[model samples]
Target: MSTVGFVMLCHTALDRAAQVARHWAEQDCPVVIHLDRRVDKASSEKLRSDLKDCGNIRFSKRHRCEWGTWSLVAASQTASEVMLAEFPDVRHIYLASGSCLPLRPVDELREYLKARPRTDFIESVTTQDVDWTVGGLNAERFQLRFPFSWKRNRLLFDRYVELQRRVGFTRKIPENLVPHLGSQWWCLTRQTLSAILQDPARKIHDAYFKRVWIPDESYYQTIARLYSTRIESRSLTLSKFDFQGKPHVFYDDHLHLLRRSDCFVARKAWPQADRLYETFLGPNHRESQMAEPAPGKIDRVFAKALERRTRGRAGLYMHSRFPRLDLENGKTCARYSVFQGFNDLFEDFEPWLSRRLGTRVHGSLFDPVRARFAGDADIYAGCLPATAALRDDNPEMFLTSLIWNTRGERQVFQFSPRDNQRICWFLSTDSNAQISVITGAWAVPLYLSNRDFSDIRKEAALMQKREVEFVNRLRNIGTRADVRVWSLAEFIEEPMENLQSILDAMDGPSAPRLTEAPRMANLDGFGQFLQNLKNQGMKPFVMGDFPATNVEMHQPTGGPRPYLVKK
Candidate 1:
């Protein structure tokens, strides 16, 4: 007669449960099964017929088990009582769910329990030390009465909790019991198990815990402490939970991950994982040498999975997992440049910057007519189209996709008041954006245009107002971009120095300074144009004070100082 016994609480997948039970029985371990009463008669009959050949396996009294209620605890009690009465030689009772799969050989588990002898393996931690409770009630779960089922009657459950809070209603906990919480699955020594089942105050304990929320998690966990000679505060089975209080189910792909866990059993195995079932339940399952269980080996992998589920991959937005705007882990993946008013100030600025930096430089990406992709292509990286309609439909995603798809290469794009202003706040808030602004440079095109002064003044006023609003956002405390703003007058005074500053920011400190500069657009009449706007009853102070003179205002003072060659 084997000393180890299994008490399985099963509600679904009766075929799989029978297979696991037969494996344990063949290894000389006695098995007691508890099928939930809610299972159909036909399926329950099939389970018994499948396992009928095994002499050591027996079916215990059935009870309807509901999650987070007393019925689950009641089922466990009846099943455990039947196991003790039927198997006199069984010394330890291991509680497992129908979904659990034995990861290690049954013989190895018996030997492991033999070594421990007196130590009970059940996670028993005080309420104060428990941090994994998902619902707000931790210690309160013990203090408050929970008559309503959380899953079936969510409205009543919540309202009752709120009412209890309002009235300060708390149930009195039975004496000699400090509330403890842990996984419902446990492995307890026969002595400790019997003491809990046959204690003189069993009725009082059951009556008090019948109203406790999720007592299965706490009943055995807390009661075992009173009788066990030695207690190891960790479960023998490997069970992982998500950020929400749901078990992580293992599939066929997770075979290697489970093996690395080195646990004897794992809970919540997917019913369809054929590979896992075949490998672990086969006759030759004892491939690994017996070793102490170390479920922590796979903890990092689960933590990463949880992070990916909650925070998601950085800069990756898709139909399946599009996170809310404020909760985005990263707005965009790579560092990209945004030029406000720079293209209007220089000739062939896009191509010139491309050659200078050996990077892709695109014209007004948010242009009102269409996105001016590099080389004027209709389609660009990530299959992003130049259509204004598509881009405008979801501007943030368009920008995020462009950056995510072309992560290895640096991207530079232009923006202006004339283009769509929808992405202003997005650019301002994103730390990945490197923004260089020449305030009021929008006036350069208007200055050179032959349009009537009346129309020019109206458009200039509108553009100035837009630029001012955009600039204020960049200046906001919440703005995270690397922003550098220069008024048109300030920038033109030392164009080369301003250009060098922009280059250093984009390319790091070691990069060579700009030896060749893009040709500055003619701005001889630009200052007079601003004055004309003012005369037309439009204040165009955004461009700052420019001289009415015809001289080149943006030209560097003189050539580099001649250097003597050392012999």
Candidate 2:
């Protein structure tokens, strides 16, 4: 049984904690919550009362907290210390804030943890002395008196931080000890947490950390560097930050942006951010509070699995029956396949696809294509959780979902294609490490820039127009060979854009900075041939035994599907 400890360190987040407590409790997972020192007992007690039914919940007493100060260290240490004592069985500790919400299901999160016993989720950020481990606190002030500490002095703290910024004295990682900085929010393994909590070398290292201006962040980085193996050095936290180096206040404008990142949680949203929180979570607007995913949610889950795999952002739960094309196809000739980049086309795609042999299929063997909105790094980032819902309960379906990330990797949401049975495709943004996808036919999104039309509402009009173009393209392409064009969107919508509601079938659910496209091609859609093959029960047939032509997959009688080779 895996456990998650949500470490809340602010009074402003008490009510949020109650909601989270109720959430995980219903999931039947254990939760350990703590209040910061300044949080009054009245609020804490009230929170405890509201969440009293939440089993396996424990609240801490020796709270040590001070905003923008090293006291945060004391608070985290105190909470973690107590957490270790109370829950010796906890395999992992996810230090989260009350404002953060789980984007993926709870079971998914736990499953991810169960696989990686050696890997730690805590990003060991590297910094010399003054570093970025949530760097608002200074180590020298750890035991300093409130009235005497310089960081405690509002005027001096600001001046000192600003001065440090002007001097441009960025942190350094000596060859012997490299430093990194990131969010304090972490998903840590027990071993890593234990080492930090009970370091025998703390006495020796403490003196050095004490000399640094802000050791709260550096202390962990230094210790982890000296200790843990290959810290990804990222807190996996993506809360919007302000110019002054503080968490930006999240508002309705930020709601959709947060979803696209495919991240498990986001942070620093204001208390009033409730409106956005309630309205836009990748799925339904209304919170279910249900123990199980509602009906037809399984398809959505499969769509996510497919999208993650395509993007290569698939985390621990990546399992696919798709045969390997790289080794046999001589993909080793290239370090990174050119196909690994982004491609986008707007018109003339429908007819092209109807001729392709890739999109055809009927019955159980015929898989419907569901599109996922991806691309445009300017839109948002995407990352998968450690674990996922069991495949048995969340079976994969052809028509899954399309996720959109506008605001250049900030907000994201899952969308259903109008034609789930027709076809689907993925595309990429021009160089600059962004991704974008066209679902069916969308009448050129206004601006097509990263700025406007950031909301999902903009999708309504394009959806209607594309559906018509889809069916026309399919019928037209099957009979014509002269047509040579491919729009990623039109291909997916052809046959019948409004064939079926894709989102109605969804169940649930990032990638890096990729560069642009320098080449362009006028290609043909292969759907027409694929459809005929599907009508044949997806049997193996060689198109033409020519190079770079139709791929022939061998199938023996009463045997399994065989290897695919280009004829």
Q: Pick the candidate with the highest lDDT.
A: 1
The clash count for each model shown is: 0, 65
User: Model 1: per-residue lDDT, tens digit, 1-567?
Assistant: 598999999999888899899989999999999999999999999999999899999999989889999999998899899899999999899999899999999888988999888989999999989999998988988899999999999999999999999999988888889888898889999999999999999999999898888999899998998899999999989999999999999999999999998899999899989999999999777755888899999999999999999999888998888899778888898899999888898888888899989988899999999999999999999899999999999898899999998989998999999989999999999999999999999999998888998888889889999999999999999999999999988887777778888999888998796767677787666677777777879988877667766535434446772221111
- In model 1, which range of ten residues has the least summed lDDT? 558-567
Task: Estimate candidate 1's RMSD in Å.
Answer: 3.1
Highest TM-score model number: 1
Model 2 residue 273 CA deviation in Å: 2.6
Error of 1 at 249 (Å): 0.6
Cα lDDT of candidate 1 equals: 0.90
Model 1 scores a TM of 0.97
Error (Å) of candidate 2 at residue 463 is 65
